[model samples]
Target: MNDPTRAPQRVQVAIIGAGPGGSVAATTLAEAGHDVLLIEAGPHLPVDSAPHFRRDEMMQKYCNGGITPSFALSTSMAYLEGCCVGGGSEINRGLYQRTPDTVVETWRRDFHVDGITCETMVPHFEACEAVARVSPLRAPAPPSSLRLQEGANRLGWRCAEVPRLVTYDDKPSGKKQSMSATFLPRFLAAGGGLMPDTRVHRLRRIGGRWSISGTRRGRTLDIEADTIFVAGGAIRTPALLKRSGIRRHVGGSLRFHPMVKVVAQFPEEINLPGMPDPVHSVKEFEPRFSMGCSISAPPLLALTMAEHPDHMTEVDRHWRHMALYYVQSTGGIGSVHNVPGFRDPLVRVQFSRSDMAELAEGLKRLCECLFAAGAVTIYPGISGGVVLRTTGGVRGLPDTLRGNRATLSALHLFATCPMGERGDRCAVDSFGKVHGVDDLYLADASLLPSPTVVNPQGSVMAIAHRNALHFLERAAHGAAKPRSSDGRTLIARSNL
Candidate 1:
């Protein structure tokens, strides 16, 4: 059966999901005078925006924001994520940091992605830095952040002001649009077009073209474009590709930044209650781990742990005087696959026991650092460990902390549709072109290829910029096609 909207509206490029990656790609391609159409799964915000984020509001607009289930060892947790307009960036705290040099080396050596050094990525990072206006998060360090920095400084360990991609103004009173506002506008101004409230349900290969079949604003639509770039993030991107039967090492190999956040109550309000997050730090513990706190706990997140009858009272006492804290761990590859007799794939994360030991060490270190900063009281978030008033009193995690489930909540999911050299057991090539699928592409955090070990917005955007440059150049002036060592025609570039 042919799609109803498959009237064959061809374009130089058809980008899926107008987030940072797609926005950058569209902007670059359009600026190069290529006719591009960007299709999004959600609505585009007004030119000016304000935060009207309510629970229901977040759910209707976000993908499983309020009632999403993520597999924890024996159970599930409600995970919140933004799916509309800017995807994660619209809802994320806008923390930006470059991928650590060590991580780059790993991809270079272990993953065989040539020319992936910090120096090689410098041009790409600089391009994105200019457009995204990347800068170190500016502000007098809050006592809470200062405490962490001071502890690290006193300990003679490495730490720095985490760079974030946000415009700071002393006079600002409310929420501001970020990537969707920044890159999306640039993309549109550069002659990019957007179709929102549109969901591409599946992809069907017809002749030489890939037809995107879906619905938009209550009408069925099918789009025929020369190329399709999937940027639906780590989860949906792989899911959609698998649904479309485009598997070539896709729909699995999931990796993520699993995090644990604790609320450390101070004598006074540490972080401005309800204010936007300003700092996201990754100190000496970088390539292996990261520590940055949340400004406020999400409701579902809060209730999930606090509602436990065992510590209801203590959790309440701590909530009133809390400062957000986080410890992030790099996960080994995990996966979700379509299960028999199930609508969605089975999702599982198997953090090595060795990794767990490392996380325990980091947790101990974080608590120790907080105590050093004159925190009069300490809360060991370990499930059964009594909230510690004297930091030294709690020597070890309660048996509860050892549970596979209900551990520190982590999200920053990535690497399902990783990029590498062709036939490298991952989905895409270094330039994000899906292996064996000519003209099909992937953008978003899903293409990270490995764990970034920190909040990865900067690296993701840079890579997107890099791939978009190569893709756009090829579209406009014919990409240099590579051949076998014997000079056989390996891959050919065709009309846009």
Candidate 2:
């Protein structure tokens, strides 16, 4: 799949990004006999050499060492995404879920997104799951996850095991179903071409074909393709489109699930590396908020504790008993923009006062649940929030949570290049095709018109699969044939 030795070549399709969306699209199109070039901005690390420590993973695969923050006026929330071949699928905790029916309904009714409903998207989701190996736990739930389940049951709130994209084999450490492990291999086997460590500097429409110029290994590279699939996530996709001068309603309407994290000290050792993330979630407060345990990797635990220097001694004393969890709630607008001469785009997220109040309530409820499950002490990961040792202290949390004292982050991001029937407002149409640009498509989380209110990997992959099928059908029927300015076929175009 990787041919760094090859100088330059033209292809029928150029997919910019090797994440789930790009991997799926490349595999599908290549299997259907299209000459596909899959480009990724980061170096490809072998799965066997992938690091286990969170800090090591961040330094290795994450963008900006996992410290990319929004340009907020006051407290900016850090947005975590990957810059490697597999993208977020490689670094994420493997929580795989279908987009909520309500979210799809809203997109259809409000945004006029066609052919994307719970019923219509199921087949695509199922197909994606089969390829990604989405499944339930093979071993028992981790102690931290069980504690969350116990607390939720005590409060009579709903909780369920989250299906993950992992290939379990009775061992504690299962192989993660990242794009590199799943679809990339299939794509490569199907004769798809991959060009890693390549960044697309500019994109131009040269007649009926798209011209792409970029740097690879400190050398210039170029390619011209009949079609371009920009699957470079929500943040980077809009930046690329804007840099390419296709700035019609792009980079607007961004949204994310802003999360507030906490470190809970229980009676037993709960910070187990074998199970880092919680397998369960308290979804009783659906659509608005949710509570789940984080992967209690020591590096992340240390990082969270570092925010509160006074509590470091206590944290270090009982690090084994500490478990990390978070309250993820919906929030308002966030945007991505391109700046000339800058490799990364500027990101800004605007959180409202009401959103802060709701997040405080969520943290309070989470503290109550943890105390019910026999937590001894809880240290809220906020700037000036005090440590709570009793249920009374947990009840008085609202007084301390003044929004300014909170240390928040955004884990899931979307809506930069939303799909809609409104030509003046949306970047892409319902079939994932860019408005006013023929054969240019977006198949990543950027295509989502709004928040899915859940982990979005399944939805992103399903949408990409569905859209790839759409492109396949169009190509089969000669509907996607490139034509000249005079409406004649561009038959002189040569194939690689």
Candidate 3:
């Protein structure tokens, strides 16, 4: 598999994006004895580098496709997305959550996603759990998670420990970067091929097959494959498809888990990341989209916390001590659409007025939790605020939160290439197949119809895994009678 000069090893299937969906799809197809080629648009950066999680790595991996993508009246903050071999799996914080039962029920009932239920989806979840090596945190920060627990416990709000998908070495100090280091190697090992630093500019359908024309090393590569799987995350997947002229609700209905991080500076050198003892995490804000605070200690990244004083003084004493806390918007869903006359497409994500208000409330609550957990000082992390010491400080937040892009960073961007029974508007069907196009499928977060209230990697992997199983089965049957399987006859169980 390491033979680089193998003369363009053609595979039965070509996949884009090396995140959980694409990687898992490759593995599933390969296991079923099909040839799968995994192509990524970026280099594979080593995760062993110090401050590897910093903004420097972010700039290298993200889509700088200019005109910082945002919703209506949003402040200008640079978004971050990993553009490496393993994609976001290499860059994500390794959290795993299945779509909640209620969430799945909503899709089945309200959203018209047929044949979907938590019970029906469980096997695929099990399969993904097996492949991705889902596990609990190696160490739990009771102190940190406890602060959140105390709040929920007092308020009688239910919370639980966050579940994750990660693999640990026995020396096993803590949760390891599971996706790139764990699952990707298996994909590479399973006779799957990888092409890095290659961009899939667009796709063209010629005759009966797909011709994906892109560039590499200043030369053009027009690849023809029997099957193509588009897993280019939420944004790029639809954008690429739309660019290739497969535009039928491909880029509309974009959803993002817009996050605002709050920083708390501790007394000692608590800002240091990756402790010696294997430490796990807590779910103080679980089942409702709030995460804990930590000091996985990146001095360079910790500097983003000019959160206090909102002035030069905090920047001068950058790394004294800092920990990060994040607030996710549960009340919002955004959109992405094509923009003419620009290299980068337009992504418009408008927070509901209620959503923005909830976001502000979450930040205030998180700040309170941090202080309760022993923060020497509490910085609201919003732009233009000196510091908010009391909960009352957040009441007048609309005035402070305006025009100061300091509180923005990207954690999860999802739901562009959505799947549903609603054709002509949704990108893919429940089986992960494209609506209008034949033999084209998308198996990533791109297929998610909306943002999951929690980390979406697990659900994405699970759903795609389930769908892949059925897709392969139907394909196998369809391939047996090639001329007859016009996709209309092989209806997905979800479709039925």
Candidate 4:
């Protein structure tokens, strides 16, 4: 690991945040012989630093120890982000999915994004998947995952195994293709620099160069870059841009997939003690909502059962018969704001009445599916929720989910800084260059125009890869020119 305190004071390109986007951007640039530096606010730990979804992993990898929450009118939704070298990829299940063609059309029509079609995005996705070794399970799906497929089959709903970014070697649980294990290493091999445990507090344009000011181990730190890529996930990316006094259409329109989980008790043993997360997901009701299984580790199971204290003992005695499942819907609007005098930003989300109704309906459908898969009892993730033993009992679920009564959480967040040519609504241009900023681009989830309605790591990497290549091509063609004070340049133009 390179020491942040002694890192170089300047670079040709500085990529902020070591998440999926940043990792891909840094690797692509470095492999092309650019002087790139990847900065991470969290420590650089090994990919297998701790067990997946375990408490120790949360403490070591997750931001805020896996307790980040966004407040709403009558409730708050907890969300998790990875803070380590690989960011969320270090913690997520690595389920991979390309951005749907319908989603691409929406972005092109709504955000006026150019050169973004299913055909155009294919090469980028294939490049990323090739490097990350995206593959299907070599072994049979775990029993827990099979339950989802069986239930969907019985209901005649579309269900399929989601291929993960893993390198299987005759094992059910294969090696995770996290950033730390893939792109970051490739970047380092290509002679890129890494500065972990350095928190960037602000970005300033100084004399046509980007000045990155932050702290490292209680000391002031600064670096100069001829170009910069802000890949600090969705929330922090907007917060950083806003903090740097670049707030035009930045954080105004955030979107995320809100999900509610349920603990289902099966008649037979299905919860294997050391199994990885389920790989199958029901896609029949997609675009609005979807259903999938979750990690049922003892601690996670206990956390999901907090509302049903009376049935807490069930986790201890019948854990072998229990697994966790969720219904996720892209039905919430949100914003990210930098809290004055605080390093962390504030997130506010609002769910419409229709959003709540959709969630309730999703919950009911999830319970029905679980019962069809042979669940004996299902515990809804609600403050005063009831236990249902049969599909008939699913009708007892509420028509609209009450904010204070239901437990809601989200794993996917995006669009705090949407990309497009629409000056009225876009923070960055169609190619990810910030609208009024020069030499500064966003290559993360923040550039996504809207919710992907699925696991977004694949999309994030593909877009970042595409945008970085675009930057390189522009530089090669001498299209990168300095701007006047009215549209100041953050980084100085450099000969590639």
Query: Candidate 1 overall Cα lDDT vs. reference?
Result: 0.66
Regions more than 4 Å wrong, model 1? 1-8, 46-57, 72-80, 169-177, 274-282, 297-301, 304-320, 339-346, 380-382, 398-402, 422-424, 476-496
Q: All predictions: root-mean-square deviation over Cα?
A: 6.2, 3.9, 6.0, 4.1
For model 3, where is the 10-residue window of minimal lDDT? 487-496
Write the residue-wise lDDT of candidate 2 on 1-496 in tens digits.
2345354466778899888888898888878877777988877886545565457778877888887867877657888888888888888878988999999899999889887789999999988888889778877888989999999999999999998998777546677889988888878777677878888888999877898888888888777778999988889999999999998889977888888899999988887655645789999998889999887765677777866788787666787798888998877688888777889999987777787888888999899889988899888888764789998997767643444677888778888988989776688998889988988999898988888899888888998999899988988899885322232212111112
Candidate 3 residue-wise lDDT, 1-496, digit = tens = 2432223434467888877788788778767766666777877666543244655656765566212546556643335566776677766666667888877876676556768998999888887777667666566543444555554555554556665555565646544544566666776666666777668888888888777877765567666677889988887898899888887877777766666776656665454345432122334554345755443344433444555434435534644455556666555556666678765666665555555666676676666655555666666557666465555554555522434434665557777777888865577887788886887999898887777777778888887787778778887788421232232211111000
Stretches of candidate 4 exceeding 4 Å from the true structure? 1-8, 170-172, 481-496
Q: Candidate 4 has what TM-score?
A: 0.95
By TM-score, the candidates rank as 4, 2, 1, 3
Alpha-carbon shift of residue 8 in model 4 (angstroms): 6.2
Candidate ranking under lDDT, highest first, comes to 4, 2, 1, 3
State the C-alpha lDDT per candidate. Answer: 0.66, 0.82, 0.64, 0.87
Question: Cα lDDT for residue 318, model 1?
Answer: 62
Which is better, 1 or 3, measured by lDDT?
Answer: 1
Model 4, 1-496: lDDT tens digits are 3344664367778899999999999999889878787888988888887878888889988899897988888757888899989899999999999998889899999999999999999999999988898888887777889998999999999998999999876555798999988898889888787878778999999988899998976888888887889999999999999999999999989998998999999889998866666899999999889999998877788888998999999999998888999999998789998888888999998888899999999999899888889889999998785888889999988898866878899889999999999888999999899998889999999999999988899999999999999988887787863222232212221111
